[model samples]
Target: MKKLIACVLTLVLAVSAVGAMAEGLTFSWWGGDARHEATQAAVAAFTEATGVTVENTYSAWSGWEDKMSQYFASDSAFDVNQVNWNWLFSFVDGEGKSKMYDLNQVADIIDLTQFADAALAQCTVNGELLAIPVSMTGRIFYWNETTWQKAGLETPKTLAELMAAGQIFAEKLGDEYYPLALGTYDKMILMVHYLECKYGTDWVTDNKLNYTVEQIAEGVQFIQDLEDAHVIPSAETLIGDGADSLDKNPKWMDGVYAGIWEWDSSASKFGAALSDGQNFVVGEYFTDIGEFQGGFTKVSLALCIANSAADKQTAAQLIEFLLNSDEGARLMNSQRGIPLSAKANALCQTEGLLDPMVAEANGKVIAWCKNGLDPQFEAAALKNSDGVYADAFDGLSYGDYDVEEAAEVLVEGINEVLGA
Candidate 1:
């Protein structure tokens, strides 16, 4: 009878051990269906190997920043979070302490050496390694060849050609079609590109505005010129379409909005969204306007551990597997852009998983970009919350403000954000 009791006790301990290994963690991110599927599969594989459970919280990009901001502020974010590059500036305290985990502290579990030195450096803020950068990205133009052909125009290689194509498209395909499509934020980036090209200067330097108010007016006016020339749909028209984002807009999928200036990592989704037989091709930078490259490249997104995580060591292990290991890399592939991990990139290349167009575009942007980007350029107060860029540009688009007025408002709003 005593022998029987010993065996039963041993069985109970085994069950308890299994329960202990089943620690649960939460991971959050923003992406489309393909990313969601790949990430879920990765998580599943991780769980199968490690006996740990991970809960996923993900959605489209719209409103994700605000949601994560709230989560971080409330100390209620997931154990693992997919963070934007600029978030490092906002999430660190005055003394340069991060609100997220110091990834360096868990170096044993996480493989920092798998990433490039420059990529890793971008994640370091205020002496603390805050997160691991997943990929690099920059904005460049992409054209739907079928749409351009339908409008009886070749792919635009210069600013003049692009403007001319706008009129041709309007005449040939009616007012519904345009040579390019730009929303409020899109206009902001494109305006920066135009200003950089025209003036041969960076957008900001030393946390101060580099361009004069009048010069900014010229930039804003250029966007107005595009609208007046019918190069893109009006802001009012996009809003009326009632889509949550450009990618979701039926007009874009149908080829009505034919061109976009977007990140190289995002090329696949845009291409996938096109109708049957529509050809998507990366376009060259408009070199005629600028002697120097106007755009900048930076870490696309990062994987970070929340300060509030109950088990940081386990979290670090999970991140390591997802970003550094062959199996996890295979599952993730290029869904999060090109992987920053040298090993992961090599793995993808060996497997033929990297999207060719995205890979080429990424290389072009990296080679061409000559300017440094400011972290504050993407500050929530400036870009999204206060809608500084959107308000100024959308006002100009809707005729609520002229170029000068819009520029003044933009400068004042940006200064306010900087001061805060």
Candidate 2:
């Protein structure tokens, strides 16, 4: 009987151990193959160190927003997932505020001070840290040094100089090479960049939503002129698809186009190409008017938090791990902007994975402006602005519309969007 009792006692201890090891966790994110591999490795490491069962949920960008909305609305959802920065305002601003976890509760689990001021500020609304910033982000000019030198033009610092360089590039490269490679389908993204050059601080401060009609007209005219001047490549000839231009042509690899405006991660493309004997460099932001002010900036990427969990403690642990761990920083590397955390930055340098330009741009990001505007307003302006480019490009190639009429039409469209 004693022998039977001993066996049963041993079995009880085994079952208890299994239960302890089964502590559940789930985290989701969107990215390509490399991000997936690195994130999985990080999770695996976390699990091995803590004996937790981590459920990884990840996908591409398409339909990611819809998936997140549904998950956030339902009870059966990931404990933590990646989100777009804009979504922070979407959720916390008016209606969706109540459905988030208080960062203070999990403060012991994660260190918030590690993140940069701008990134951290974006996550804070009404003095609450809604999400942790994993990376720094902004728009930047990426140029192919090889292509520019071949054209015999230095990198342009001002907008006027950029136009001159573009003409020279077009003259030399002829039809095969574009002075500036533009992702045509995504031209809407460029509208803000051009607007920044035209209006300066007024673009963000004076006319975030309420710009005078004349100002809008001026901004629209500026873009049309750039298109008319042949600075931007013809859409039909160069861009196959707007959404995936970076992956498809990878301007740095082609060695034909001079430069393109893109996000922080763009530098990595050049850096990656260099590993294979291709060389490139990141250029400073260029403006047409007075000293070039900083160009368009994105408010932030998504901040993630959990709604339901069997054990909030475990979920918090995982969140802290990804946000503050050196292993997590290396796993993501520069794939996500620069690390949002200063500690994360130091960790990356220690690992020899830091990108210098990205580090610099992260310092200049516009902060506390994540809210107080609507993207739909920007979208409307873009639709109207498109006409300016469409008319200019079509007229130049075919010689139909005169310069004055083309400029007038562009100005009119901007005025309409601005409600002037």
The sequence of per-residue lDDT tens digits that candidate 2 reaches over residues 255-301 is: 66666666664345444543244456666665455343535455445
Residue pair clashes in candidate 1: none
The C-alpha stretches of model 1 lying farther than 4 A from their native spots are 1-21, 93-96
Top candidate, metric TM-score? 1
**Global lDDT scores for all candidate models:** 0.88, 0.60
Steric clashes per prediction: 0, 8
Q: Residue 42 of candidate 2: its Cα lDDT?
A: 78
